[model samples]
Target: MKNSAMIEACLACFAACEMCATECIKMISADHLRCIALCRDCAEICALCIKLEQRDSEFSHDVMQLCVESCTACAAECEKFAAHHDHCRECAEVCRKCASECQAA
Candidate 1:
């Protein structure tokens, strides 16, 4: 059974991603915008997957795969922008961890 901790962590990550994405979108430079969008999408998918896993839904397998891939992509994108932003670095670390966990699912 998925515990509350996993969900909480994922939710926190989602929030961080959203915040980072929003900040990136407002920047004058367009460099990190795509990366930020990817991160936001990845975080959202992870959140959905976590919720499904907690419910033990039959669709959890498919959702987990999607979430894992999204996180992997997000982590890669974050790595590209990490040097430019601390939030990107932080998001990358979290996304990597989340990717690993999703892969295990």
Candidate 2:
């Protein structure tokens, strides 16, 4: 994407989400299931948004909107586990940043 900040944010968010999902999967409790799903969805959406932006697709803006929503949702989910999970805290931070960048774009 031409917007470097948004692009970087998305990339960072994607990586964070992926890492958080892996950590959640390794947990013994079922409480992490929802967080895992949200992280996975957020990661995919962030990646897709990056690709769409790179291609300069006509629907990129629309896709970006969805990306923002996904990030927001992921951030909320991650925040619930942030107190105990360092990965979730990091993921939530990145997702929030990405969502802000997407909204600005």
Candidate 3:
């Protein structure tokens, strides 16, 4: 349970990212394409990080690093649409938290 906090953060971020991506798709446009792609990638990376950490994989640290990067990028992209999208705002916040947790882990 050493990585409990990190896992929790990743779970939250994963949910947020998925929700954001779904919303983005509903409002699909050229401007939202990057946001959607980033959210999807971030969610996938968060899920992978959770699995790696749970099993205490040898590559957990490496994956966490990648997760941090992914979350950071996703958060930034989502933030751009925060003014017009609640889901993007929420996802950005969760992504930031997850990135912080991943860095700590």
Q: Could you give the candidate ranking by TM-score, starting with the highest? A: 3, 2, 1
RMSD of each: 1.9, 0.9, 0.7
lDDT of 1: 0.77
lDDT of 1 by residue, 39-100 (tens): 77977787787778788989988987887788778888888878888888888888777767
**Which candidate leads the pack in TM-score?**
3
User: Total clashing residue pairs per candidate?
Assistant: 0, 0, 0
Clashing pairs in 3: none
What are the runs in model 3 whose C-alpha is more than 4 Å off? none
Which has the higher lDDT value, candidate number 1 or candidate number 2? Answer: 2
Instruction: Please report the candidate that would top lDDT against the real structure.
Output: 3
- Residue ranges of candidate 1 with Cα displaced over 4 Å: 1-9
Ranked by lDDT, top first: 3, 2, 1
**Model 2 lDDT tens row, 1-105:** 488999999999999999999999998669989899999999999999899899898988998999999999999989998898899999999999999999999
Question: What are the clashing pairs of model 2?
Answer: none
